[model samples]
Target chain A: MSHKIGFEGYKHENNVGFFGKENSKDGKDGKEGKDDICPVATQVHHLIELY
Target chain B: MILVLGQCSDQVIGAFMHHCVKHSVDFAFVDLNQLGKSIDMDELYWFFPGQSPVSHSDITGVYNRFLDWPKQNKYQMDRLLSLFDWLDHRYENVINRPKDTMSNLSKPYQLDIASQFFSWSIPKTNIIMNTQIKIKSPFICKSISSERSIVNQVYRQEEKAFYEPALLQAYIPGLNIRVHACDDVIVAVGIQSDAVDYRYSRFENDIFMYHLPGQVEKDILALNRTLGLRFSGVDLIYHNKKYYFLEANPSPGYAYFESQLSRPYISEALVSSLSRSIH
Candidate 1:
């Protein structure tokens, strides 16, 4: 089964806003804003394979 | 002139502004987050803070990218509503008016329209809200409305009754495909992710350009036209050598897909369309 463990417990739920600007909700710096990664600070189980 | 409406921090709006500058397209940006106390609205003119009042005749088109209403004073909210009302009732050449985009609020309604185009397949789905009905195992549950929610598989053993209404859909195992149509231009990208909802996937999604069949592309364009949208992002599942239509996003965040491509096809198409004078 390709289930992502603890997906409900993650920090970012809505996957809101892509760009970051001054006083933006997503991030303070544009660097962090553009960076798309898992919000949680731990490794996750990987499943599914597509080419 | 083209009027771009929404917050400056939104990537889609930012991309439109960037393209406008790069392409020398005459345009104006109304940052919704920066609205001050009030805006003076008359039949033909609107006066925002720190700028001369703009005549309605001066705008040929409007690119609306409003996500959610930011926390605003009562005066700002009233002014925003006034603007929204005018844009819906009196405007032409709006990429999409708010009212026209209402179909997206109901996923089943959108799917009903998608069902018209026979080229693509739609998964077996149902909206369960305070009703008794038989359902199969290995199904997924998601938000019935356009409200963002992560797609999660429903275990048969869990409580069958949902506290809140949700859409239960048969889980079709396959690769995910996102097709973005900007007016007549459509771009397809295949997403390979292990996560049920690719948006929240922890692993990096393998996004690659997918060349869709000629008829499929045409039908998608037709579907967009039927939905009264000049731009949309459609979700599909490629299963058993057939494409299954999931849902259509009227206000698509195309920046993520555009970032992966060598050229910004979606944004460029939008800019080109918005740049043209309505007259």
Candidate 2:
């Protein structure tokens, strides 16, 4: 077995309840989370926008 | 009035909206998700979901976090292009103009800019395509572009060769400090983690406020100014009494750091700066 670096292998599993996801206490995908800080709401291609 | 540009799903946009409402700041949310649906725009005015059409002249500042339009139609594509051009050329307080954010698209280019600042030292980096260039023993692989990729340590010789161009740099071991600068406010946070990429670390990492040296903080603000970025999140590694510049995230997903802090320092600074044109 190969060692996973960072979130390499665990990304899929950890996506459900990552560090920022904890804000979504109501479990509505951050709809009612504290201050509405939902991690999932961010775009996948966050920084870059391909022209 | 502040013009907020982003999709309805974006949390940073949500957080900014919350701040505006809480502070009694007048603003309009232009959800890009509704670009062609509920929203319509002529050359001079914008029609939001539920409000009177607003003239471009009325907007004093813009908080633009548009990653991409939700749909890709003829109208959407043209509007996206026009909007991007406007964001790039607009004189109003744009947190970060699109062209300024283009620096992050190329890590090598960004590193070159960082190298200009005295407080930052860049790791020996090589962007290789088909050719093999050797760096010191302990090196890590990173994405050449702004696209996210987990930083991986190269243990084997085979890993050094890249079929596609990638950034290979001498790994600097130390604390990860993220510096967020909005206009004049700079908030620095340190992350203590064992994983190569602390952002995706499986183990819990300690997040706390970090105070940068006065000169280093000044240099960071200068770098932001040089890049023409009103807002940015700079990544730095402090190792052996030196700080290594990683990269600056123009459209930083700051909600993560703000969640850990007692107050949303970055967001607050950002919102305050965006609303500054009013008072």
Strongest candidate by lDDT: 2
CA deviation > 4 Å runs, candidate 1: A1-51, B36-41, B46-53, B131-136, B154-159
Model 2 chain B weakest 10-residue run by lDDT = B152-161
Against the unseen true structure, what C-alpha lDDT does each candidate score? 0.70, 0.71
DockQ of each: 0.03, 0.04
lDDT of 1 by residue, B215-271 (tens): 889999998888888888888999999999998887777766676677778878887
User: Which residue ranges in model 2 land beyond 4 Å of their true spot?
Assistant: A1-22, A25-51, B132-136, B152-159
Tell me the chain A TM-score of model 1: 0.23
Instruction: Give the fraction of reference interface contacts each candidate recovers.
Output: 0.01, 0.02
- Candidate 2 docking band: incorrect
Tens digits of per-residue lDDT, candidate 2, B1-279, equal: 788787655556665555555566777776676666666677889776446778888777888887664667888767776777777785467877877887777889889988998887999998888876555477888888877776745543443558798888887889999888888899999999878787656666788999999988899889988888878888899999999999888887776677688876776787677766643
The true-versus-predicted C-alpha distance at residue B72 of model 2, in Å, is: 2.1
Instruction: Give the lDDT of residue B146 in candidate 2.
Output: 79
Q: Is the docking of candidate 1 incorrect, acceptable, medium or high quality?
A: incorrect
